[model samples]
Target chain A: MLEAPAVAALTILILALFVGVEVISKVPPLLHTPLMSGSNAISGITVVGAILAAGSEHDAVAQWLGFAAVVFATVNVVGGFLVTNRMLAMFKKNPKSDA
Target chain B: MSSTDLIQFSYLVAAVLFILGLRNLSSPKTAALGNQMAAVGMLIAIVATLMVQGVVDYTLIVAGIVVGGLIGGVTALRIKMTDMPQMVALLNGFGGAASVLVAGAEVSSRITAGDVPTGIIPGAIVASVLIGGVTLTGSLIAFAKLQELMRGAPIQYPAQQYINALLALGTVAACFFLGMAPLDPQLFGLLVGLALLLGILLVIPIGGADMPVVIALLNSYSGLAACATGFVLDNSALVISGSLVGASGLILTKIMCDAMNRSLANVLFGAFGAVDASAAAGGEGVDQGTATAYTPIDAAVIFSNARSVIVVPGYGMAVAQAQHAVRELTDTLADNGIEVNFAIHPVAGRMPGHMNVLLAEADVPYERLVEMDEINPQFPETDVALVLGANDVVNPAAREDESSPIYGMPVLEVDRAQHVFVIKRSMNPGFAGIQNPLFFKDNTMMIFGDAKKVVIELNDAVKNY
Candidate 1:
């Protein structure tokens, strides 16, 4: 069983998650597109978690799970970056027009 | 490196990266960098997880990596700009599905082990099963709607809301029962199925106009599922990241709803903006009057003689990539001593700020872009309002009739202008899937062609004038 401090820490973390979600929910539409693209970056944290899990010493099953997590995380990271690039590319000023 | 310490450190780093990435996502210029930073964080977490677990079989891992990479790369390279929204929807659905799968797998593994704590196991199983099921079904429906495979409007029946309410109640009762016996895989699966059905039923009635909001809401649902799974697995990083996504997604959804001046209930159940038979029939009392459609020269003549011109751009302009041409025309008109400006409706394109981004790309000065409120009063004084690739935003019916789906929604009031030159592909209505009555109005002249081509033609016409 986890100690009181560990439980408290977990509780605090969970509460923080709720708070973060609330903050995001209140943002206006004008900010949503940018916010989504921005949040895509934040979603990258899963990659970090996956990487750390993979790198740590673990049993075979744990190792395989960690590896799978890494693979998924990488896909998310790369795919998100590519999409964001494409989206931003739309904003590139047409070179032909000077005015 | 102890497993517990390694996991804690990995989660800490992941949390920090998530926080930073979210902060960076707040602005456009730094959004990409924020994404990169988060990716790096995710990479770190994955590596740490692997290290802690100590897996020797690289074959399966490598194969999975190769296949996933190929698919993702090809998708990125092949998809067109127009299909970006659909692609986003698909990706979001996949994320939701993944979380659900993960939760399901975890629950199954726990149950098979037969060593799970009776009290905690049931809650974990129920949370994972229910959340995952809802996320999967909801996201798939959202994807189908966005892809246009399913009708984009609310498919309504009498007492539909009441039926949905009953389904919700039933789902809740089923979830409670499943929680009482989490080790029963059959019951867990049943609960999941029910939740999935509920999600589909919830989203099916929403109209296409509210798709952005629905997509955002589904995204939130997916995040919540992931967060719930995190609780089941006791993963701090997952909880933090999932909650962040869920929260941000909900916020975006709300913003989209507000932009459309809709409520969450209306978006889910109100059948808002559904184009029924009445909407398709066009205006009832107003007699359809035929007007002499003006040519570029005829419109240019009016504009040349006029004191002010306001340009209203919509999704058509973005589709045509006519912003540059439009910009040139505006500049040419300004040079001719004609005061030119732009009128931008809040929901003018596929996504928020779409018109602004497109116009800005053409190097249109920020000052020239006018919001609907600021420019509506000026429309009466304005000699001409050139509507490019826009139909619904400038529709007078939005304000004229109470029965209309879009009625009471603020419009450009372009009909009030002395002359309205509308450049469009055809007489088709907008994404709202309704016919625009403004096309048949007396003051409006349809310049039928590609918006980009028409704008260039207008530029030439104005220059000659």
Candidate 2:
């Protein structure tokens, strides 16, 4: 049987999936790369789990695994955000559109 | 409020910011701010995570962050925009690998504490490890293919499907055993190895042309892997954000497949390119007739007399590094009272929206970049269509030749334009190995040269005119 917390987590995940669909449904073709890379940065949420695993007093092997995870997750977050920002910075408005 | 309560609130705030950030990212103007908002959300979450009750090793945590941050940040800053697909694939792999390691550490700690993982923990471990392993290796293969480190076409062997099916079954079997005996490290290792192998097998059969779908699908897997890690750790922030990323990647995958007029199953298993084999059969012998070659002066003459032009760019633009030259041409034509708009196909270049990003990098205004649907109607009324290093997307055969491999896939209808000038390095067919009849058509003129060089000459000619 699923515990109360597990049940709640599942509900949140299902709800979030639909919300994700609804929120990003209208992104134009021009922004697909940024939308992809931006949402990709968000998936680096694994860093939260990685930090917990790394900082806790686990066995040596477990500690090493968590340490590696921290490094990898941080890369995903930092790289993803910077690249998305870099791409977005290049998009200037069309001067003619002002008229 | 207590520290645990504060941490939960921070996670809630992070999730809300992520949602708002993605919502604002659809438009070009607010996209930079949206990215910054998400970055801030990550900072808040990481800070709150550091302050949790049992989290004590500040030294190890800080060291890991520093090392990872340096590598990731430097690569992000220095890598060219043209190599973006490879960079995205590599970073996505890191996320998946982190989830796998986190899951491994969780199970190892449980075993080290002398208790077997039972109930939902075992299943969560299975899901996280399996998906994460697949994403890690799969993305590396995508990186290799895109960077030209490996063969870009689908690498197929005899009985490839049969062997892959067997490998999939073996992975499932290993997963089932690991689930049953959660404390068994040997079984876990076997599962991990099998997953890595399965990832390679899955990606190798896919061709270079279908990379958008491959990258999108792998992006989705990394998110699901993170969601599974959330279940292993009983964390909600990971669950919600993971699901959102999963959904976004899936939607992009669907859109890409639709653009190619192929199903998701087909993209995954169709072994689309097989270009070498098809090319060997008829690649060199297709007598589509002699294409009329022209110079930039002639092109400039046609363009000066014309009123409007549309640019169709493909992978060649990225290869030639010609986005800036194309922008110069756009400016040259605009000064001559000629309207120029870029028609972007969804599956153009290595990724979705890739052409727009390339053009935007050249400081071309976002308004001049038009979607395939919006610009298709205007092509019939336009004067000249200058195609640069693009092939399959503009091939008239996609609409006319039922026997063509790329038939029925939606292509930019540039043939309908009054005059078309195509710049290509050679007469070789496109990535799909399909000969394009558009080049030999009556209204078309082929300019043989590098895309960047040719565009510069066209700009010079237009200036002299």
Candidate 3:
């Protein structure tokens, strides 16, 4: 039931994923912490995609699934920011405290 | 906008946000704001997708939002800083699990409808299932070790590496079979199991010293799995974002490997830190005599007499919550016009940036912190190097002897300082289970006590002096 365009799109996506892997393999380790915290933000795209796919349909199941993806993605996005904030806070030298 | 155009635009926006986030993260000052920008961009993208799709039944979505938000907010507020690494591991695992579930559901739905296409879905399913399984199990083990619920040492057995290799091979075979016949639920389950086992085996033989690298590598796997899931769903935004994460994580992992002088193959198969008895044998440094006596000096003598002071912090500084105390001591010295600098080696503590985080928390000025290369030359000129619970990073054997387990590994040259004052509870070896020769050196003095207490005492001594 699949068409050529759909197949081609999927192939391109797969190739992109492979390329991404290759790119990651090349980055240095000193940047791992910052990279992870940054990439976490990018992963939020899943939430958006899930919402679109699920919301476009009229079915209850699709709506609920999309809702779940949104929730998960939101948690990931928000938690990432919170943790990053806390981490950055640690670096903010308290000026008043001597000990 | 047309539906396709809207989706394409969203992808572009998400990609731009990712690039900006990465750029912002390059420096400590902008990292937090960068995270915020990325988060807001993600929110915008998510809302846009939902609006464009126009779904009914926002009730469940609202409920999910409430529940997820509550959990996330509470966990963020409650989790201690010391447990940050474990928290990261758990989060990474969750991401992997979500991708696996998404891929599994898609594959099952396709199979049940009698769609056994030999191309995209099958490949995506295999990739997602495999990578997810590995990431989930590996991350759990890492979390356990970081939490101290499991041993940090590599759990080894006879032919452990071979068994791990076999598991990897089995996983590949399962992936191939799944690709050939996508409808086989049994093969899918087997593949997942094999991948899970491979993940465990992969982590089991990796010692604690290499955990930061392992965690980074596992994170990359999780990102790749998510990207594969995006393909299965045909979501362009997911594909773009997931690919960015996957690429960045892998690069970071490779960098960490290079810092340790390790190859990816060695990291994956060499069973690093699972040394044999011969490898663990005490080097010539350990044969040195242990002294039980030292004349305790007053604080005034330490500050007034010393021309220059170096501060060495370790994992204990992170544990005892003594970074603030250490910072205070530095400030007190700076008040006396005594020069002070912090020495950070490449692998100073549990993770790469452990001390950096600790000191930064204490509000230690960035300019005062020095890297190993910059600080090594100043050690001889340093009148005193105050080691605050550091062990392995200051060990001189890493540079002097070829037979040492950590040979060729760069370490902070604190021992080269004119006077070394080590504040520790006892003469215990570090996580590497190797005694430090610097502890017993003629010029070295061990001040036995809790790090936090000792630092505070040192502060008091400097103040009274």
Candidate 4:
């Protein structure tokens, strides 16, 4: 089912996969949880696809499904970012009261 | 360039920002900026997708954003640092469920229009539905376990492995059939049901302690499902970001396994939740029947006079919500001219990064919180190891007792310290359900009480000096 353009896309996918591993390799174990949460938040980019699916002209069943998808994906994206920020905020170099 | 060309360019830019965001997030210095970068990338992606031609139904989209944004914002603000893991699990599950719904909707709509996905479209649809279903249910079970709504121990029965294998195979077969017959909603629905069940079965047998790895793996699964959704929709941004998440999550999962000194196969198939018979039996310290106890004053005196102290925290600390009190103890010790550091095991809390987040929430300095490898050597020269509700991570059995199930797992070596003070409710074995010889060591003294109260007492006692 993949055409020539898809072959190019697959190549990009393979390369991106390696880049992902390389970037995460240096993360200190201290930040492993935040990294997981942060990366998990990034995966919320699916909100884009959710929007497209929801906006498309389709049957009622499909429309409702699309609407639900939009809601779920948005929550992932928004919640993920805000939560990651909150965690990282606590990781300041010095305790606020101590300094 | 035309408007369409401009929209595609924005997507390309968003993808690049995401990569940059991930890169920046690897270290502590730039993590916050990294998160913002990713968020901005997401915002751009959303706007660019909205700008696509033939888009409509602004009312439904607006309502979704408002409601979802409200839910996400409110929950993120209200959730305590201790509950972060479950929150992440729920969000990951939401991402998975969205992919399933979107793909299902798209397929059903195509069928309604008398159109069938030929070639790779059908395959992508099948992949999305199958993986998304698994992630959705699997994450929910993880959340339930972390939230203490259900037993955190692994749940298994006879022929469990066989049942899971059969379910996996059946789910795959259903996916293949759906791929071949995209017009058949019944086949598609059957595949979804099987995949969801497979997810529940897959996660139910994992012990609570191993949740970080499970959560990471499921995060990757969600990413793969999103990638499949990207393929179904022919969206480049989705494909790129999805593959990025899938690869990164897999690597993090491997790291979690290494930290615990166990293989992924062992975590999944080892039935770690089942209490070990041998661990339950009597041994050198186990035969003693009870650990030696000490008063809060003695612990305070020992900590105050110590040249260096290392606080090793575990799941019990989180359960007792003692991080704030522990921080107070650290402060009292520091005011007395003693150096203090926190040693965190990789799998220390119910979830990954649990201890660190808790400590950070308590305003613990980032520099003072040390990793296992970095702090192991320090234990020998240390004067006191203040163990707050931590167990198996400090157990000598992981290193000294080869017959032990946790043998060969890297531990915090707190036993090497001149004196050890353990603050626990009782002589209960740790999450692995194993007796720790460290609790019965000659120099080790157990303080019987809740971690929060004991730490507070220790802090007050130190103040008296």
Candidate 5:
């Protein structure tokens, strides 16, 4: 829809799909929770859409919807990252760190 | 470079950071840094998108970010690790809901001004709304079940499947109608409504036992919805990152299903209340078994004398917050020259790697924990199999009982060990609802109590041994 050709966008989409699957094939089972939560944070990139939605001056209704979208997307982004960090923080190896 | 080029370059940079972050996340040592890298990528993408043309007012945008960030940050920092599955589910739901709002705003604004595109935009909007709506509600239901705010068992009524089928058909029909009359908010609203209902109906039939798969699948759905929204907006960043989430999430879901030896269809539609059904039917054989019981003192003597012990922890261990106690018990055994190892079932706790985190929190050495496949063969040579608050994963039925609902699934071969001590609160069946015949076996002894208390008592007893 923008200046980028549809074919190029689709190309990115297709290649990303393949790389996504390949990157996660060997994640150790111990890190599965962090992996899921970490990838979850990546999906929070939808905050991009939320920012555009909120800033667009379509109409009062559209503005309100956009505002709400920004809020939810922000929560998804901020919360997902913080929670993932907390989980991964526990995965450290410590012979003397155990309580 | 022009602003457009800058935006595109920033997106490219973000995508590269995301890829690097994902690569680093594969190992335990680098995961935290990987998460930080992805966060920085998201920040760059957001800041760059803020510079895009359509954005007008900074007040509402700033307000939304502050309020939402405060809530999300506080909750994430405050929640117990044990409640993480539900937190993740809720976050996934918020992502889906964000997509629905963005897509809805985009389409409704366009339709309000007769700005309909003659291309795939309409279809993209519909897909975004549909998937986003479904993901939002489905994740909410998942969160509720995990939080115990709703029943964790499958909730089915007569003709539930038929009703779900009708809802799916109606939602699709509404989408087609909206495609023709994009100006009609009523039709779009109906599409969203039906999709939301379908989401609830879809997840409610699945029990808590299958939540890991459900959570991962819903996470994937959120990504797909965002990807569709990206197409509607022609935003390359969303499309790329969303596809990454959708693809990796699907793989994780498959891993969860495979770990449990169940297919995706079985997880989604198996409606595993058959155990409850037979129980309600009041079959005598199902209710007739009793397990041999032991005390903490008795377990202490057995554990102290054993040369090697393998501890298996499960959902009950999490509930009892006994990971620390289990660690102490292990330490006591170690002092007595016992080699202690932990066997972790893939779906051990409410979520994937749940027990691992809990064990790690108690400072149990990571090297001492072993996966199901790797630890299965070691059980036979182990002097004792200590099951603390674990159930179905250790059930011999998966290996021996052909008629059991969990018959074909792979389980820990704890029965192979020379002596099996099951520390539980009672003889209740686990989440799977089927009785564990291992409890009544000749070598298995049940020590009944709160897992944390029992483990502590055992630790004390062993200390004095």
Candidate 6:
């Protein structure tokens, strides 16, 4: 329904949404914390956009905005991944129990 | 291939990794591997972005990442497991803020260069800012509530809904105007203010008991904010990954709402905060039947004699930091040949799976933590049910009391066990502010005290027996 360039990206977004819903709904309660935390981390993909903004050949004022964006995105990326790992590390299965 | 083609190809691979990563997170066995794969995907996306044509300055980028990395890394490592909800809320806020700042910078710079955005770019920028702004402040409010910096009760007033509706309409109108005229800095500033204020007002009316749903919804907003920023920049990687997270958070929000037997709209605006005024004034719920107080010694007697015992824990266990103490009882009961398993309701603690995180931190095996649906049938065959700091989850009112506010919410049927011992501080209603008839049942005994102290006493008694 749009231009050639926007169409490909929009199509990707639509397919990814379906993939996300299908895959995430299968996660059991056993890993709900991890699932939520992990997906939250993936949303930090905005780091790509932030990085592009920061490094653009714009004026100093614009570059500073990119700088601020980088810091916030970095926090989400770093904190989210580490916290998910710590929680995942705690999940243990009993070798003897069938469940 | 050209460098442009290389970046595109890398993003495609990164997207695939993200999908596979989430797929792997479905099981306990591969969950950690799933996390690592997503991390790798993030790294690839970042590296490929750095290879873009206009990205020449490294000093500011490196400095920001270093500073942010230190702060994010230290906090993630230092925060207690009990504080995970707040931690997630705070990080989600940062994600939103980053999208806002990034999009704001691009638009401001383009304006400065006398090249105001036309076509869909203006709409995309407005969406990114509006959604990101709400996600930012909304997440902070959620963090404040979970962190106890703000009151956990629902703060409501007359015409709250009308005010929210008006503000929402005004914001939408301003956004539409911005898309049409793109140069009114004053209007842009007004839009930003309205977005932030709306976020706060949206979350303030919801009580702490529903913060999980609010946080899940805010998490979705964060992802959607990023997706809009992707449209602003025409980046497929950001759009793909962001929408994936958006869909995931929406699914979680829906699951949490269903567990509480509430709708998404109800959770956002229901103000489920007004507790029964009469019960609050009386200083305690109506203790219809007698609740015979049982000592730890009596609890131990049941444990030693019973063949199987189910432990039902709630937010009270988290508050008292009693997971480790409860684990001791689990070990003691198992030593005596009692089949010990934990019954976990879907919404037992402050957040979904909150109880499981705390129990896992205390070395509770994954196999022993059973979800409600699977363990409900087992409760009827169990010899005893040990309830710690949990009230509403075991309440029969959910299934039996049609008039109750929490009717039909799935709860752990702890009352079905042959004998039930509930450890609580008093006869107060649960966080949902409802009276639990399960405590007054003929087979139930109230063992009142701090959860940790009571659990320790029960462990010692069982060990000595």
Candidate 2 residue-wise lDDT, B1-465, digit = tens: 999999999998999999989988878888889889999999999999999998987767888899889988999899898898898888778988999999999888888899886668788999999999999999999999999999888888999989998998888888888889988999999988988888888999888888999998999999999999999888989999999999989999999988888899998898876755655577447777789999999998899899999999999999899999999889878877888888999999998888988998988888888888889999999999999998989988888888777789998999999999999999887777677899999999999999999999999998997
The lDDT, on a scale of 0 to 1, for candidate 6 is 0.86
Q: List the residue pairs that clash in candidate 4.
A: none
True contacts kept of each: 0.24, 0.82, 0.34, 0.70, 0.73, 0.76
Name the top lDDT candidate. Answer: 2
Flag regions of model 5 displaced more than 4 Å.
Answer: A1-4, A96-99, B274-276, B279-289
Q: Model 5, range B198-219, lDDT digits (tens) per residue?
A: 8899999998888888988988
Predicted candidate 4 versus true structure: per-residue lDDT over B231-306, tens digit per residue: 8877788888888889877887887898788999999888884876654764544465457899999887777678
Q: What is the lDDT of residue B64 in candidate 3?
A: 58
Q: Which candidate, 1 or 5, has the higher DockQ?
A: 5
Weakest lDDT window of 10 consecutive positions for candidate 2 chain B: B275-284
Q: TM-score of chain A, model 3? A: 0.59
Q: How many residue pairs clash (N, CA or C atoms closer than 3 angstroms) in each of the candidate models, in the order given?
A: 45, 0, 11, 0, 0, 0
Q: Please, what are the lDDT tens digits per residue for candidate 3 over residues B1-465?
A: 787687668666765675566666666566667677777667667666555645444566566567656766677668766566676677677667667656655555455556665546678778878887888899898888887789888788988767776777777788999888876878877887887887787787777767777777777776777777777776666776776677666666765666555687876666665545664564533567774444334434756788799998877777788888888878888888888888876555555455666676567866566777778999989999988877867888888867666666678888888888888878756666665778778888888888898888778877876
Q: What's the C-alpha lDDT at position B169 in model 5?
A: 84
**Residue lDDT tens for model 1, B1-465:** 688698679777877776676666555456556656666676666566555554444555555456556665677667655455565565555455555455455554455556564534456557656765676677677778766798776777888978988988988898888777665667766787888888788878876666677767766665666566566666677777778877777767766666566678776777765665665665534575654456787778887798789999987886687888888888898887888888987667655555765665567765577777788999989888899887777878788766666777678999999888888887666766755778888788888889998888888988897
lDDT of each: 0.66, 0.89, 0.69, 0.85, 0.85, 0.86
Query: Which TM-score does chain B of candidate 4 obtain?
Result: 0.97
TM-score of each: 0.81, 0.97, 0.87, 0.96, 0.96, 0.96
For all candidates, state DockQ relative to the true structure. Answer: 0.30, 0.74, 0.34, 0.69, 0.63, 0.68
Q: Quote the TM-score that chain A achieves in each candidate.
A: 0.58, 0.89, 0.59, 0.86, 0.84, 0.86
Model 6: CAPRI class: medium
- The all-Cα superposition gives candidate 2 an RMSD in Å to the true structure of 1.7
Poorest stretch of ten by lDDT in candidate 6 chain A: A90-99
TM-score of 3: 0.87
